[model samples]
Target: MSATRDLHDLGQSLWLDNITRDMLGDGTLAAHISDRDVTGLTSNPTIFEHAVAAGDAYDGSIRASVEAGKDGEGAFFDLALEDITRAADLFRPIHDKTDGVDGFVSLEVSPQLVRDTAATLAQAKELHARGDRPNLFIKIPGTPEGLPAIEEAIFAGIPVNVTLLFDAKQYLAAADAYLRGIERRVEAGLNPQVASVASIFISRWDVAVKDSAPEGYKNRLGIAVVQQAYVAYLELVASARVQRLLNEGARPQRALWASTGTKDPEASDTLYIEAFASPLTVNTMPEKTLIAFADHGKVGEPLARDGGDSEQVLAAFEAAGIGVDALAERLQQEGADAFQKSWDSLLEQIATKSQALTA
Candidate 1:
């Protein structure tokens, strides 16, 4: 069996971290779903930016939107939604088969609203309503301001993929917001089955501390952090509060591992996928990494629910003068900033394309 099938059989979800019109039109995404067992997908501003800039697929759409007097972000989202809705439809079968537990496609709200809670909530709701797909998740950052919006969106029955989380603390905070929203629904005598996922980014930790950590610790930070988070996730599900909600028909928010693409050339290309193979968690990998894993990946023992050796490894980092708390905050900020930069570039690309096509 292919390693991708191995991972799926191990109960870990392998989602593609990309989407494009060509992939959809050419049966590439469908082939992955059929052959590689890919169950879900994720998209961000950067992904859309690349998709728009790389091909003539979006040019006609952008030109039409421009003629209709839409430009910049407005024009871009129309094109993005066109692709996402189609992808969502393709995954709708698995979505129904799994009863909404898997087979999700995520669309991120504009990063420009990262700090604006009100606007973020509005856009999330608008996009969720516009897409009108049950399997679609509107991604919201896990920033301080975004937590409230996450809760609001969840309470309103919209599935959310909470992005930009860096550590266990951030992950728990996002989870808390999700629980709060569900608890509210329970109190109001509403169904609490609104699904959500807290996306904790991996790989960035190793990238952040590679030069600073000693040789032995160079590529180990990211996995250790994920292990720690997974432990916390297990504990939370077993907690009395969460258990109470579970009894009331509410589901625990699943933790998803994002940014799994390996950044270090010397490290194993499947480093994150192999190290963090835990059940009930989603790992969205880039296309290259997914292909690499399907070709030569080895499925190792699953991640320990008890977080074996994670505390010890974290302590080692502390001893080496690495302040994890401070670094987490820094990384989240950097991630938000990077998305904003990408969003700006994407809008610029749309303008350039629109003008050329219209002329």
Candidate 2:
């Protein structure tokens, strides 16, 4: 069996961290589903920006959306939803097979809404309604401003994929917001089984510390941080609070490994995917990383529930003058800013493309 299928059989979901209208139309995404075991996908401003700017693949759609009176962000979301909803439909069977746990395609709200809770919540509701696909998850950042929006979005019964979490603390904060949302639902006599996933980014950690770290610490910080988070995840899953919620029919918010692609050319392409091989979590890899893994990646034993040497490795970083807490905050902020930049560029691309296509 392919290593992709091996990971799936091990119970760790493998989701593609990309989607393009061309791929959807050409059966590329379908091939990943059948041959490589990719059950779902995710999209963001950067991904969409690249798709729209790459070629004339979306030219006809852009012309139509423009003719239909859509412009700026309106036209972009219309274009994006067209692709995301179709991907969601393709994953619908896996979604049904897993009872809404596995198959989900995520669409993020406007990154500009990151600081404004009300705007974020409003746009989330709007996008969720606009998509109208049960398997679609409207992504919200896990920033301080975004936590309240996440809780409110969940209480409002919209499934969420909480993004931009960098460490266990951020992951826990995101998880708390999700639980609070479920609690509100149960209190109001509503269904508490809203699906959600907290995405924790890897690789960026190693890149951040690469220059200062000693040789022994190279490419290890990210794995240690994720291991620590996995230990916390196991504990949370076994906690009495979560147990009570399960009994109340509320679904658990699963952990997702994002940014798994190795940025450093010297490192293994499948570094993060192999490190995070375990059940009950999701690893969303880039197309390049996914293909590399299928071609030759090996799945090792599952991560130790005790976190193995994570604590020790982290202590070494601390002793070497690295502060994990402060670094986590900085990474999340930087990630949010990067997405906003991409969103701005995406809008510009849409406006330019629509004009060129019309002419």
Candidate 3:
């Protein structure tokens, strides 16, 4: 069996962190679902930006949106919605069979609204409703300002994939927001069964510390960070608060490892995927990584719930003068800014493409 199937059997979800109109039209995405055990997918401004800018696949749709009096962000969403909803439909069976535990496709709000609590909430609701798919998750950044929006969005009955989290603390904060939303729902006599996932980016930590670390520490920080986060996740789900919520029919916001593609040439292509394998978590990987993993990946024993050796590994980094707490905050901010830059470029691309297709 393919290693992808092994990971699936191990109960770690493998979601493709990519989407494109061409992939959908060409049966590639469907094949990944059927053949590679990819139960879900995720999209960001960067992914959509690349999709729209890459080929003539989107040209006809861009022209139609332009002719229909849409441009810029509006045109982009119209295009994105079409692709996401279609992907959502393709995964609907897994979604139904798993009873909402898997088979989700995430669509993020404009990164420009990351700091705007009210606007973020509004757009999240709008996008969730617009998509009208049960398995769709409207992604909101896990920034401070975004926490309230996340709470509000979840309370309002929208499933959220909280993004931009860099470490365990950030993941906890996102979890708090999700739980608060569920608690509020229970208080208001509403269904507290809203599904959510807190996405903790994995590879970026290694990238951030690669230059300053010793040879022994290279490409290890990210896995250690995720291991630590997994400990926290295990604790959170086992806590009385979360257990109570679970009894009340609320779902736990699962830990999701994102940014999992190896950025280092010397590293194993499946570096993050192999080390971060644990049940009850999601690993959303790039297309290259997914294909690489299926081709030659190996799954080891699952991560230790107690975070074996993670503290010791992190202590080595700390001894090397890496302040992990501060670094997490910086990475989160940098991630948001990078997404915002991509969002801006995406809008510009839509506008430019709209004109080109129309002219």
Q: Report the Cα lDDT for candidate 2.
A: 0.93
Candidate 3 TM-score versus the reference? 0.99
What is every candidate's alpha-carbon RMSD to the true fold?
0.8, 0.9, 0.9
lDDT (Cα, 0-100) at 91 in candidate 3: 97
Give each model's clash number.
0, 0, 0
Q: What TM-score fits each model?
A: 0.99, 0.98, 0.99
Worst lDDT 10-window in candidate 3: 350-359
89-124: candidate 2 lDDT, tens digit per residue: 999999999998989999999999999999999999
User: All models: lDDT?
Assistant: 0.93, 0.93, 0.93
Model 2 / residue 331 / CA error / Å: 0.4
What TM-score would candidate 2 get against the native? 0.98
Error of 2 at 289 (Å): 0.6
Question: Over the stretch 226-323, how does candidate 3's per-residue lDDT look in tens digits?
Answer: 98899999999999999999999988899999999999999999999999889999999999999999999999889888888889889998998899
Model 1, position 35: C-alpha lDDT score = 88
